[model samples]
Target: MKFTRNASANWKGTGMDGKGTINTESKILNDAQLSFKTRFADGVGTNPEELIAAAHSGCFTMQLSFILTEAGFVPENLDTKAKLAFEDGTITTIHLDLEAAVPGLEDTQFQELAQKAKAICPVSKLLNAEITLTATLLS
Candidate 1:
């Protein structure tokens, strides 16, 4: 299977004055010079980490749902959070915290399914960082 999205950025002057745009249609990018914290990059605007978080959370939940359904269970609630941590001017790691409630399934079964999802999710497979999944089953 293959999927792709393209992004582009333009920068000038240095850390403060540079800006860019994100074009979803062109698979290109938006202004990213100021980053998310600054208005130069809109909060709702596009950046690599936020996009990665969205992908990870969405894919993880979907994969978990499918696996649980195949195991004869339905999810009560599923929440996935991804935190991208940077260090030394590089993406050091992406930490995932996932909580799930699957009715009619044992804790062991839920954990197994969650683990499987973590292993097989597309974003998880694409990232080289250490990904962690924390799943909770609530009746």
Candidate 2:
């Protein structure tokens, strides 16, 4: 199967004084505001790094579930956090932290699966920056 997603942004006026809105085809984000203050200084609304992190976290979580199921393990719960680091106007790194509860799964097995997901997930492969993963198995 093949799929595509699209999001568009429109900005007007100068960088410091201008404002923009982002809209996604899914409509989950409708006319979301973004500006220089929002990107650098911490104002209201979402920014690019925030959106990237959300996508990474969501994709990694789903990939982990698929890997666990394929290995005959049922995933009870999986929580993933993606931290994106931006420096000098460039995205430097992405860190993924995963907390998982899987019944009847050993630490070694869980770690292997998490590592595979981190390496092979679609979003992970698409990123050019460094990617790190920390997996914790919860009882």
Candidate 3:
């Protein structure tokens, strides 16, 4: 399947002093503010890295759920936390911490499926950085 998603950003002034607003086609992030301080320091706005983290976590979790379902295991819950490391103006790595409760799924099988999901997720394929995953199977 081929599809397109859209998001736009409008900025003004210099890099450090400039400010921008990000808007998505779905309007989930309508007029969200972004600034240098927001990216570098602790500011009251969202940054690209944070957004990437959110997207990666959501994508990876969904992919895992699909894999689990296909493997005949119904997941009671899946929680993923994606941590992105950015340095030297480049994305260095993304780490995914996943805790899942899947009925009748073995730990080894869960780990294997989680690895497959990390490798095949759309966002993971799009990124040019190292991706790591730590998966915990809960009873």
- TM-score of each candidate? 0.77, 0.97, 0.98
RMSD of each: 3.6, 0.8, 0.6
lDDT of each: 0.73, 0.93, 0.95
Sorted by TM-score, highest first, which candidate order results? 3, 2, 1
For residues 24-48, write the lDDT of model 1, one tens digit per residue. 5453443433343443335545566
By lDDT rank, best first, the candidates go 3, 2, 1
Candidate with better TM-score, 2 vs 3: 3
lDDT of 3 by residue, 1-139 (tens): 8999999999999999999999999999999999999999999989999999999999999999999999999999999999999999999999999999998998988899999999999999999999999999988
**Candidate 1 lDDT for residue 61:** 91
Pairs that collide in candidate 3 are: none
> Which parts of model 3 are misplaced by more than 4 Å?
none
Worst 10 residues of 1 by lDDT: 32-41
**Over 4 Å off, model 2:** none
Judged by lDDT, which candidate is best? 3
Count of residue pairs whose backbone atoms collide, per candidate: 9, 0, 0
User: Where does model 1 exceed 4 Å of error?
Assistant: 1-15, 26-46
Residue 25 deviation, candidate 2, in Å? Answer: 0.9
